[model samples]
Target: MNLTLKIWRQKGPQDKGKMVEYKVTDISEHMSFLEMMDVLNEQLTNKGGEPVAFDHDCREGICGMCSMYINGEAHGPDRGVTTCQLHMRMFKDGDTITIEPFRAKAFPVIKDLVVDRSSFDRIQQAGGFISVNTSGNTQDANAIPIDKHAADEAMDAATCIGCGACVASCKNSSAMLFVGAKVSQYALLPQGQIEATDRVKNMVAQMDLEGFGNCTNTGACEVECPKGISLENIARMNREFFSASIKG
Candidate 1:
């Protein structure tokens, strides 16, 4: 297939960026989106032109680093997959693909398709973990009985990869879904009960501090999320936050 790619190019955070067009010919449907990009970069490099800069690692879709806004959709037209897992088959021959970086005030563009997502790391650090006593007196995690339904829900929430699709897809660039998932992953588990109050409060505080917008219940985040994280997590987080507020 022959394809025209209109990709965003920016030298730095302060650089004025625009969509630059490039053409790739003879692309196979079997090639992953990033692989097709590799072909485009190879063409550019051979012609002594600068290659397009996009973030990608572990192209199998686990790393959550392959961030792209394709034709106004997070992770392209496909559902429940990251940019790296997208394939050429999703587009027809001679298609014009518009590729851009995931836009959010919290995620400042670095260069080309790369954006600074360290804000997510900071949010996680705010209180996404539990303090476990590893001493001899500590109870065995396996011995603790957890309700199957709660365990399943917790596992579902744990699937969030922090890819920012939730933020990019939201009209307000809300990180609530992501934060909710992170919070729910703990809130539903017995091990997380100890820090539940501080966990929700601190994570929400950090999310707000990072300039991410508030959620208006649009449900765009769950629709675009690769892991299919549920809106129920957001509700759970809200309940946790409200309870924490009352306790304080």
Candidate 2:
């Protein structure tokens, strides 16, 4: 298949960026989006031109490193999949796919299709760690059996890979979905109860400090999240936050 790609080109964070166009031919429908990108890069290299720069670690979608805004949608036109998991068949021949990095004040572009996502790291770091009873008097981990439903939900929440799709998809650039998933993963389980109050407070504080916008209940984050992280997690996080606020 032949396609035209209008990709953002930026030399550095401080450099002015613009959309640059190119053409690719004979792309297989089975090729994962990243593979198609590799083909584009190869073509550029063969012509002595700088190739597009995008992030991808573990193309299997486990890492969530392949962040791209394709044709105005986070992770392209697919549902419940990361950019690396997107396939060429999602589009057709003679298609013009516009690709850019995830855009948010918190996610500034570092270069072409690569953004500074260390902000997410800082938000996560602000959550700190869960308290564990490692003392000699510790009970067996399996002794305090968690409810099956809560445990399952907690595990689901833990599936979040820290991808910024929530932020990118939000009109307000809110990260509530991501933060909600992080908080809920622990909030649902007994092991996470000890630091629940501080966990929610500190993480929310850090989220605000990072310049991420507030959630307006638009539900765009859940719609774009590759992991299918639910909006219910956001509601649970709000409850956790309010409860923490009340206690203090």
Identify the leading candidate in terms of TM-score.
1
Tens-place lDDT per residue, model 2, 1-248, is 99999999999999999999999999999999999999999999999999899999999989989899999999999999999999999999999999989999999999999999898898888884686667888878789989999999998999999889999999999989999999999999988998999999999999999999989999998988999999999999999999999999
Give the lDDT of residue 248 in candidate 2: 100
> What is the C-alpha lDDT profile of model 1 across 92-144, one tens digit per residue?
99999999999999999999999999999999999999997778788878899
- Return the TM-score for each candidate structure: 0.98, 0.97
> What TM-score would you give candidate 2 relative to the actual structure?
0.97
User: lDDT (0-100) at residue 144 of candidate 1?
Assistant: 91
Candidate number achieving the greatest lDDT relative to the actual structure: 1
> Would you list the C-alpha lDDT of every candidate in the order shown?
0.95, 0.94
